[model samples]
Structure formats: C-alpha cells, structure tokens
Target: MPKSVLLLWLEGHLQSWGYDSKFGVRETLPFPTKSGVIGLICCALGEKDPQDDFLKELASSTMEVKAYKNKFNDKTEQGLSLIMRDFQTIGTNYDESDPFKNLMIPKKSDGTKPVGSGAVLTYRYAIQNGKFAVFLEYEKDLAQAVYKALQKPRWDLYLGRKSYIPTEFIAQGIFNSKEEASQKLRQLAEIKKLTEDFSVVEGKNCDDCDVLLLNDVPVSFGRRKSYANRYVSIIKKED
Candidate 1:
C-alpha cells in the first residue's frame, strides 16, 4: 500500500525534547525525539493506555525532520537557536502535618527525609525559538485519523513541554508523498522567513551525513518507560 505523509510544524519559543535525562538534570536534543512525537500523538488521541502495538508499527515507519531557524539579522540575537537551561528547586518547604502538603516534600525511596536539606535542584534544557518540519510516513487510514486528531485535538497540544504551547497549528496538511510534504514546508518556511539548518533522516550511514544511534524508540510508556535504539543520518546545510 502507498504510504501517506503527515506533516507537523513544531514551532515555539521554548520546547524541550528530552533524550537522556536524570532526575537532577533534564537534557534536550536539538530536534524532536521519536518518543516525544509519539507522546504528543497519544495525547491528541486521548489514549490513556499504553499503545504498545501502535508503537511496534511506528518503529518500522519512516520519519524525517528538517530543522529551521530564524534568518540572522541585525535585530535577531543569534543566527541559530540556542539551548536554554532552566533551574528549579523542588521540595523547599512543606508542612508535614497536612497529608496533601506532605506529599510535596522530597522523600527517600523508603519515605524518609534526607539528612541534609530537603530541597532538590534540577536543571532543564530547552531549545529557544526552534522550528521544525516533521514528515511521518504512515498507512493511509492511520494518517487520516492522526491528521484529523491533530486538527481538533482531544487534549491540548504543546511543543515538547506543557508550558510550551504551539504558536501555530500543529496539523499542517496530509500529503500523498514526501515530495508534496516538502513543497508545503518550503512554502511555509518562505512565509515565516526561516532558514534551513539541518535534516535528520532514518537509515544506514551515508558519506555526506553523520550517523547517530539514538535510543528514542518507545518500547512502553507510563510509569516504567523504556526505549530501543535506532540509527539516524544527520545532514547539515550551510547558510
């Protein structure tokens, strides 16, 4: 069966696509991860259960991302979007007497207070003023359903973080082929005055691209989340 392409335009002031992160530090990749994209879709579909079967099919589907940045000018601060780190302190102060408030306090695995201060410091990284055009290849029926859901999402849609709401519509259009999706992206970029930074494509390594093994594939979601690795090719372009 011929595949259809669902084009998503991800643009926001602050968006974080967490690749490898710990409790102390949450790091973000330059582009959207597969898990992140899938999570957004699940939210749009209003699916609470873990979609393990859907993920299995998604793992084999082709997905491509083209990164874009605002054109450099005297008014703009930088030519490329930069990563911004946000520091937060949790469990600073809470009354133990109140049951609800006590849960907010930091505790050990055994529900005991720490010997030192109860405050926990965490650093979150996000891409500032980042834009991306994502093309996802899917079967015709699945693509149409996803396209409709994104158009009128059951749940609110955010870029990567809940606070980072999308400035534009997430569903751009559904195309019959990747070339058609690329055409739409070019038109949108021209209207937005954005310049291409790079492209990430899935598959074997090529001489002109950089190969990266990313563990962004979702095996299961919910409390105990896991992922598998996939090879991607990154091709950088000049201004």
Candidate 2:
C-alpha cells in the first residue's frame, strides 16, 4: 500500500507525554508516545468516540521522533531540565449534596465516597522547553485527512495537556516518504538554532540502542480507555 509521512514540529514551554505514574503522581516520558500523538490527531478531527477502527488502520504504521535542544557547542551537549514537578491538589471542599460538586469528590470504584477529607495531592511532572519533530507514516488517504484536520483543527491543539499550548505550528506538511519529512525536520531545527539531542524510533531491541516497552498504543479512547504494548528504541546523539 502507498504511504505518506507527516512532519509535526512540537515545540512548547511545557509538555507531558505520560507513560507511567497514577492519579496521585503523574510522570512524563522524555519523548512523545504513540497514544499521545493519536490523541492529538483525534482532537483535531473532533473525534470523541472510541475510534477503535480508525486506530486499527494505523496499528502497524511507523513513527519516529527527533528530540532537539538549544545549541550550545559542538563539544558540549546542552538541554533544559528533563522534568519539572508541579504540586497540586484535587477534590477539596466540595459539598456531596451538590450534584456538580459531588462529581468532583473522590470516590471508590463502587461509587461510594472515599474515607478521608476527599482531597488528594498530586505531583505532576512535565518537560520544560521541549522541542521535537515527529514523523508519522500513514496510508495516503488517512494521511490526507489528518493533514487537512491539522490545518484547521476542530478543537484546540495542545502539545500534551490542554494547558501546554504549542509555541510553533504542529502541522509542518505531509510528504511522500519518511526521508522527505526528516529532511524538513533538519531544516526546521537549523532555522530554530536547535541541536539534535536524541531520537525515539519504533522497533524491537537492538545492540546499539536502549529498548523500552511501553503500554501506550491506543486501542480505545473514551471513558474506558485501553492500550497495548509497543517496543521503541531510544538512541541518544553521540557527542
């Protein structure tokens, strides 16, 4: 089948690509996850459904990410801090009688109220000053739909979380091949005075890279979200 590649320039002051951690302590991965990217695409298409069929079509698609940082020098590798922690509190002082406020209160799986003040503390981590170029290979027809949706997204497009607004345009363009998208990525990095820091490529374990298994492939997307595992290779740029 014919394929197309999309070049997405993801640059933002704050972004969180969640991989692990729970409600009390949310952590972020160093790079974007397939699930997160798919979420962005769904948002652009204004698709709030489970979208099992749509996601299945690109189940075997190729995705590559190029991480960038502020250029310091050829000998020195310079980048902002990997993680930024933000402390917050949820479900505080809500009346159980008020239906709207009652929904905010923490509840047990059985729908009963929690055993405490119903307030919980959370530690959210995000990437600071993150910049990445993502190359997503898709079927020609699906790629065109995604391209058009991104140009005028139905909903606001964010890097990861809603608050993490992108500094640069996410839709660079669609190309005929991954190589074409990569060349565009290099040009964008050069124009922005950014240097390559690392990369995440979809694949199994290899001798020259760090292999990671992530349960981030989306299977369903509504209230009861489900995911599958995928292997990716992370290769840091050699100094």
Candidate 3:
C-alpha cells in the first residue's frame, strides 16, 4: 500500500527544532531530529516525560524529510537572492557552583536514550520570504487524523522552541499534491487578507541572499535543565 503523506507549511519569522535542550539556555539540533518531532507528538497528545507505551509505538513508525533553500529580495534593485548559512552554537562560560552537582548528572535512563534510532525524522526546508513546507508520512488513518487536527488546531502552534509562538496558524493542511497544497495555502492567505508577508510559492533553492541558521545551545538551570530550545532568528517583515 502507498504511504499517506500530510503536507504542512510552517511560515513564520523564526523556527527552531530543539532535540536536546536544558535549562535557561536551549539547544537546537541541525535538522528536526526524531526526538524533537516525537516530543511534538507527545505534546499534541498532552503527554510529558516518563513516556507511556503508546508513545513508544508512535516513535517506532517511519519518517522522512527534504529541506529547501530560503530566498530574500533586494529592495533597491527588486532582485531576489538565496539567504543561507551554517548555524553554530556559542556557549556561555560559567563555573559549576551547584552543591548537588554529583547527584544532578544524568542516570542510565536519561543518558542511554538513542537520538536517531526512532520512528520520527524531519527535514529542514528554508523558503524564500519565510515560507517552507513539511511532508509527514504515516499510517493512512493516522495521517488523515493528524491532518484534520492541524486544520483547526486545538492548541497554539509554536516553533519547536516555545518562546516563538506563531501569531498565525503555521500549517495550512494535508493535500493530495504539492500544487493543490500550494493553492489551498493561497486561498487561506486570501481569507486572512494577508499580503506578501504570507506569500506561498514553489521553489527549492534561494540565490544571492544571506540566510543564517541559528542553533540554540543549552545552558544550565539550577538543578534540572529546561526542555525548551533557545535558538531563534528575528526577521523584519518587509511591507
């Protein structure tokens, strides 16, 4: 049987996928890692750590990805260019002053968990003007259910990092084809009466632009670390 795919477009000023993050400072993995996406699924299901059996089952499924290039336009010349960069993390130097340092370190359950050997995999796609698409493949029934839930989401959508909550619904919907998905997204833009800031288009790569990928590196809290990733990019929307 053919796999069912749910195509979602996340358009926003900033997006981050935090795989392994700790306290005050968070860290973002290069691409949307399996753990990160699984965390999302858990969140959607209103679950937390000490995961249940269902969570394990969900994590055992297959996932794939394809990233695209982001582009920007030169106002003076009305020319478009690709804006891309390799992201890096800068750590803040600080001395460990914790009295419970010995007891706070990871135990077997925390440190032994594998990062990549799971059911979820994500691709990072950067689009021109902050527009990008995500294609999720899963069991047909599950895919359809997820697609339907996303259309009128019960919970607010935020970049993997919770700090950057989207002002609008980032995902448009699941569609039969890319073209159909694009058209539906356009229709949504029209309904919202949005302008170029919310424009959706087709293209894989960007040219002649400086797109920087920011990776959030985790920092320590007091005893336990925060799960949120802190990597973010602030883009000024052109009017």
> Model 3: which ten-residue window has the lowest total lDDT?
196-205
Task: State each model's C-alpha RMSD to the native.
Answer: 2.5, 2.4, 12.7
Number of the top lDDT candidate: 2
Q: Write the per-residue lDDT of candidate 3 for residues 1-239, one digit (tens) a residue.
A: 45455665544555566544444334443344444455554555454545545544554443332232333342222212233332433222222366465334333455552343222223332212233344556666776766665655555556565654554554456655556755765565455444332121122224532233332222222245333223222222354
How big is the positional error of residue 115 in model 2, measured in Å on the Cα after superposition? 10
**Between 1 and 2, whose TM-score is larger?**
2
Instruction: Give the residue spans of candidate 3 off by over 4 A.
Output: 45-51, 72-132, 167-172, 175-239
Candidate 2 overall lDDT versus native: 0.87
Candidate 3 matches the true fold with a TM-score of: 0.44
lDDT at 58 for candidate 3?
51
Best candidate according to TM-score? 2
lDDT of 1 by residue, 87-186 (tens): 9998876878999998888899898998876999889999988888899989898888889999988998987889999888889999998899989999
- TM-score per prediction, in order, is 0.90, 0.91, 0.44
Residues 1-239, model 2: lDDT tens digits: 69899998888999999998797999999888899998998899999878899877755577888898887565444554478999999988888799999898988889888887877789999999999888888889999999999889999999789999999999999999877887888888888888888888888746878999999999998999999998899988876
lDDT to native, each model: 0.85, 0.87, 0.43
